[model samples]
Target: MRTRFPLILLLNAAGVALFMSWYLPENHGLWSTLDLAIFHFFNQGLSADNLGYAWFLAIINNRAFDGCALLAMGGLMLSFWLKEDPDGRRRIVVIGLVMLLAAVIINQLAQNLIPVTRSSPSVSVPGVHRVRDFIAFSTKDGSRDSFPGDHGMMLLIFASFMLRYFGRRAFLISLVIFVAFAFPRVMIGAHWFTDIAVGSLTAVLIGVPWVLLTPVSDKLIGLFARNLPHFTKMNRAIK
Candidate 1:
């Protein structure tokens, strides 16, 4: 647990460095290709009449699910504090805070490494009239970037902790929440599909190894176990 926070920080920093050095430069081209692929693959099944509905669902899924995830995490933390011993609660809080701060720093550093560009005026693609318009709208409208989606990353982090403490059910729930939240950034024109893909990958890169290397997760679970009696008492009282 003591070493875990530092390891997460180190891994996130390395990821930022790698993204800046290699990924960011090629993102625009790569994203364009991906966009074309999606359009071609889905265009057959997609009609203008249904496009609005799809977009609406995507936005709702992204924003609403993310809010729910945040609420869930807050509830879990509150429960931990109320049920755990002071020392246990304190340790869990500290670990959570450290991980959050690390994630924020990584996000900021990644953003700085990948410079934001003003939207381009126009773009053209062979055999596709719509591609140019899509590119112009996405880029010129200030929609796409490669710094990673903070909403997605944060939710994933929260889910990781939930999984650590609550097992498979919590893990599966968080996974659903993450996917739901990611859909909005794409639907609402805030991120490219690739942005979500890479953002998720980036979160995993930082989150998984960090959790594995740290004792914080075990500490948190132990705190919950030790305080189960108090929690039961409190729940009974509420009932």
Candidate 2:
């Protein structure tokens, strides 16, 4: 536990430094340029003539599509749950609960801590195409305060937790899913590139290591396992 202190401090420092590097400049530096470039590259696909492309963005950006992402994450989790023994399954459940609880708490704390209320590219950028404009059905195409993307942060937290509890394979797969699902907002102009790359990611970097690297998460999981309802029948059903 003591050995992890240096690494944890390093990661936390890196996260803070990365955030401050961009924040202090107030989006006028290279980060802003990169944000604009990435935004334009993706937003350009939502042209009036490109109905197919526009529809693709609209479909993925819809609220219903979020369920698909959740299902994908759940499916990955189920794969592990089904393979484990009863004891392992219980542990998995504890970890899952911890991951979820930590994600919610940390996300809320980060939002409050980093209160940079900024608009999405669709609202702030000039002459930009919006997914909502292209689709007949409602879709997310903008945000009043887009800093620190909640969606991407949740995905990142899941991936990070997977790395801590599961193995590298789970981590890699979750990381892929994170990238796959988290970028729709950027593609649709609902979020700037920095919203995910800098904001959400920075929070994850700063926050996740502390919970995952130390004994904190393990102790919490153990507490839950001891106090929460036993899953003997639940385990047998799986068997």
Candidate 3:
């Protein structure tokens, strides 16, 4: 079951990419209304003091989250090599590759649903000096057409995996990071409220299946043992 978690994640990610590609831009009215409400809600009492939070949120709403997701994948791969577990490492690498491929395919499909538009000087709302703020505003100008933020999806993916491998603490930390990172996109007009909502949901849809598929520790151990030689060579190269 544990062995299947990565595969499940990949499948779900593919589904989300497909959904976003198929439906978006055409439903801009609904997306705009939702984004406006959420934007105003978060805007209340927001100020420069929470700039750090704003910065993190911006990262999650933008392509920066992609970088973080890739980093997490690298870390997982390194863990397998360090453990000298070839089967384990292979599974992780395979899952990561699948997820990436799905992302590319989905991206291409989504491009047809919503073409990327150039950024204009749009509205400037006070107390929203971040990427999310821009995304929220972009909804009005049609500059922010991406229905779901990929960054949020990746963050959730990382968080879900951490919860499975580590503990509740890791889960909590990842959750906080995910929220923080996602908020800025809405605040700055980079994405609509609906985009964030769907992005987050997309993560859950992918993550739950992954959890169900992955087996517990014992099976993982057996699988690792079976591919020990490959892992050993990889580890030696790392050293």
Which tens-of-lDDT digit does each residue in 50-127 have in candidate 2?
Answer: 999988888888899999999999999999999999788888988989999999998998899995889998998878
Task: Give each model's whole-structure lDDT.
Answer: 0.54, 0.89, 0.52
TM-score of 3: 0.47
* Model 2 residue 151 lDDT score: 96
TM-score for every candidate vs. truth?
0.54, 0.93, 0.47
lDDT of 3: 0.52
lDDT of 2: 0.89
lDDT of 1 by residue, 27-56 (tens): 455566775565445333324445554444
Q: What stretches of model 1 exceed 4 Å from their correct place?
A: 2-32, 39-55, 58-66, 75-95, 114-146, 163-169, 203-239
Global Cα RMSD, each model: 7.7, 2.4, 8.4
Predicted structure 2, TM vs. truth: 0.93
